[model samples]
Target: MSDLIEVRNLGKTYRKATGLFNHKEVIALARVSFTLQAGETLAVVGETGSGKSTLAKLLVGIEQPDQGEIWYAGSQINCSEYRKTNQFIRYIFQDPARSLNPNQKIAEILHAVLRYSTVLSFDQREQKISQTLRLLGLLNEHANYYPHMFSGGQLQRVALARALILDPKVLILDEALTALDPSLRAQIVNLLLELQQNTGIAYLLITNQLRLVRHFADHTMVLHRGECLDYGPTAKIFANPVHEFSRKLINSVQY
Candidate 1:
């Protein structure tokens, strides 16, 4: 059980203009550090503006960190290199419908990822697409349907399919389950667990859902104002949070 992803003293800052020639520097993340083990889920719980999204963006190379380092598979991840070889780590956005192209059919959307990310032949790509569709419980005909034609759950499955098409070792789920209803959320959570069991893909789950964190994550990290307030096993942390902020967060959730 080696770590698949590691972050060391990670920090990020954003500057906002206040008045003419004046600016305010806001710390989006400050010296945050954690490790995601292979085949394990690490939930990052925090309120809005706690830098959860910022951490996700940095992990997926969407934004460069001002300081610190990220290592994947024991190799340092250069932001520029990551963008070119990002098949190893994928990101699934919170809103599947918005994340996907509304105008493109499902087949087109998936094929675009396959074409750009891999060197598979046309027939091979088609076979891969079919396989992914089946794995996600979607039919071949669903590929011809637009994103708008599918239900929220189905659209999320499609998004998952797109992320998995590249055979990534890790996934950054940025509030990926927040938009779904309770039943659908449970379904997706089970699906994620099943997928991880089968493929050994590690997950970095960023969300404020305490129930989901307790049920789905192996470990948890609590953030407050872009800093880590607590980090430990999910059960232990929930049972007895050492940090005041972590305790408050757990109490805020309705049983």
Candidate 2:
């Protein structure tokens, strides 16, 4: 596999009102660096304020970094290039199907993406929708159903279908599996692994699920209070965490 995404010295800051005439700069993420290879899985783990979401936003073009360079498929991109980046790197919100339109059928929801993102005609769009839906183990008929009609596991697949519909090269899974029960999470994990095996779609799994990271990720990035505390192979980091904070984090979870 070759480098698919490269992030160098990424940083983000936010200004919050502190007083009547004063504001404070809160560094959400700073000096973060990493690379993701084609078909590779990189798990980003951190606490609430560790800037995991900030990193996800930057990757998907939802937000721009204050300082740093993001390279995709060997070319550089900034916030303004989000629409272009979006076609290649897709994001799935943590709320699962709730991110979907309650009033729209699945087909309509997916059709909207194809209708705008590509020039595919109605027939092509319909064909692509069938293929994408089936790719996530959903039937074509389900596309006509509303999100509320599906079970929790099925809803997760619908969300996956939305992201996969674009045929994106990379997926920024922004804690997408957090809400699923363990059994459902396991099924989704297996499905994702299968997809990666077949499609070579890389994943930037921004999540707090260390167990998932330990078993599923090729590498792990540990973030703490807007800083990268440690980063390395999953086995190496789990067996011998370099930083005290990292050790504490690993110890917090049961193997």
Worst 10 residues of 1 by lDDT: 79-88
Clashing residue pairs for model 1: none
Clashes of each: 0, 0
Local accuracy of candidate 2 as per-residue lDDT tens digits, 66-184: 89999998898966788877888999999976699999999999999998789999999999999998888889899899999999999989999988999999998998999999999
Give candidate 1 misplaced runs (Cα > 4 Å).
none
Kindly report which residue pairs in candidate 2 clash with one another: none
**Model 1 Cα lDDT, one tens digit per residue, 33-145:** 99988899999999999999999999888899999999988888996788655898999999888889888999999899989988999999999999999998899999999
TM-score for each of the candidates: 0.98, 0.98
The all-Cα superposition gives candidate 2 an RMSD in Å to the true structure of 1.0
